[model samples]
Target: MMYKADHKDSFPEKPGLAGLKVLADQNYLSDPAVFRNPADAKTTLAGELKALAPNNVSYVYFGALPDVPVAPAKMPLAFERPDLRLNGNLCVLFGDGHVESLTVPVEVDDCEELVSYLHTQKKYSEKELKALSERAHLLDGELGL
Candidate 1:
């Protein structure tokens, strides 16, 4: 789903990308430009490009659990709220680089199970990983990097 500052006041009229084919076509998914480390760039080109085509950009933030193999007896609350239920380990990032947090839900005994479940997820699958690597390679080729 695409989120914009101007549209923050209202929810999207549609859920997900349905009738936005033309817009999607013009914008590249998994574009290396989106992944280029903003810190490494000496100039403001990255910011300029992001400003020019904000929809085509995405910044991923992978949150890591402190003790991977061992899940705590009581999971940390996302905030001060005690009634809210937090879910399992997630790799979520916002379109903007504003927020990043890890929320894992599972007992110490279930850590292996959670890991296994994550391994089966399509995003971490070998095929998808290879495709992403190839896409990055292709982008580098285009840039003559």
Candidate 2:
């Protein structure tokens, strides 16, 4: 609301999860409570909030634009409830402000593809991506990707 009111009904400049903390610090949001996911009991924003650490944030932003001009139905704004095995689900927030929960099959190929995409986008360094891929299987239950 604060962002849209100031930016002519536009969203924030970046669509990353970290941006939420930025907004909170800037007073656009009352606090970082909005960043907390219900399923993640371990995460909190009471103390100093750091986007890089993310502590317990369950959702991942999909590189949304500042103005958010993409098609509402197709664009995935964020997702959560990630698991690698045993009925893990992906909850997606569409561009239209609608939430949908879908079962996304987590396979080795899918994980590899996502790692490649993240590397191409420079979300992490080559070394980090390599390490993530190597430990992807071990992190199945704990990984948020």
Candidate 3:
């Protein structure tokens, strides 16, 4: 709202996780706790959004989802805990305001598999990959992926 008002009714051009801070930076959003990943009992909001959680955050913006040709409902706006976190269940929010928790198909279940899958689409920093790897666990248990 406030952000779009000032920026030609638009959010950041390529809003990533840190882009959420763009709102905070403008005082549009003040609490970084809203962005904290519940799965990660470690880092704080400052370390997560401000420092750009190389490890993992609660939600990630799919800023690159095609806009012109694709419909809003088809576009992925953001997702929660896709990095083998939260029991492989991802809460995806589409551009049309629909939210769904999708489980990663059994085939791609571990950090290595998810990392490889991401490799096909985008490049993640080695630090980020290592972080995901360190938390990799396929079972449904506490802090177990």
Candidate 4:
């Protein structure tokens, strides 16, 4: 919210993980540890964020927010992918700053199922593909999934 107030009531141009970097740089979200959701013990941000883990924070961020004002419930800023996080529901952060847990159908606890799901996405962007690929490889080598 403070970021919006300073940036003409708009969000960072970059979407997803990169966009979160902006907030971190601006001190809006200072603690890098907070980026890693507690449920996601297997994944962690690389480089400066290294914390006895590999990769980046977990969550599918929707950074390209709509310009026109709309109901907060309709604007989902970020959501947790419970597949590898070992959670049965998705923890979503809405535009209104409210978090909701939505039940999903994925086999949350099984790392093998999570890897399979990442590989079978119908239409994933290059970023998604890279993330999914890295995560899959990590699971294969580390977790023996």
Please, what is the TM-score per model? 0.25, 0.55, 0.57, 0.60
- Clash number for every model? 1, 0, 0, 1
Model 4: residues >4 Å from true position, as ranges? 45-54, 67-70, 107-145
Per-model CA lDDT versus the true structure = 0.28, 0.49, 0.51, 0.55
TM-score of model 4 (CA atoms): 0.60
Q: Which 10 successive residues of model 3 have the least lDDT summed?
A: 134-143
Candidate 4, residue 113: CA error in Å?
A: 15
Write candidate 2's Cα lDDT for 102-129 as tens digits: 6544642233444353344335545555
Candidates arranged by lDDT, highest first: 4, 3, 2, 1
List model 1 lDDT by residue over 14-113, tens digit each.
2112212222334533343543334323222234332422132222112112322112211111111111113432333222322334454444112222
Query: Once superposed on the true structure, which residue ranges of model 2 sit more than 4 Å away at CA?
Result: 41-46, 50-52, 66-69, 81-86, 108-145
Point out the worst 10-residue segment of candidate 4 by lDDT.
Answer: 110-119
State the local distance difference test value for candidate 2: 0.49
Query: How would the candidate models be sorted by TM-score, starting from the highest?
Result: 4, 3, 2, 1
Which residues of candidate 1, in runs, are more than 4 Å off? 3-41, 45-123
Quote the positional error of residue 25 for candidate 4 in Å. Answer: 1.5
Please estimate how well model 1 matches the true structure, expressed as its whole-model Cα lDDT.
0.28
Name the top TM-score candidate. 4
RMSD for each model, in Å, please?
15.1, 8.5, 9.2, 8.0
- Judging by TM-score, tell me the better candidate of 1 and 3: 3
**Model 2, position 76: C-alpha lDDT score:** 49
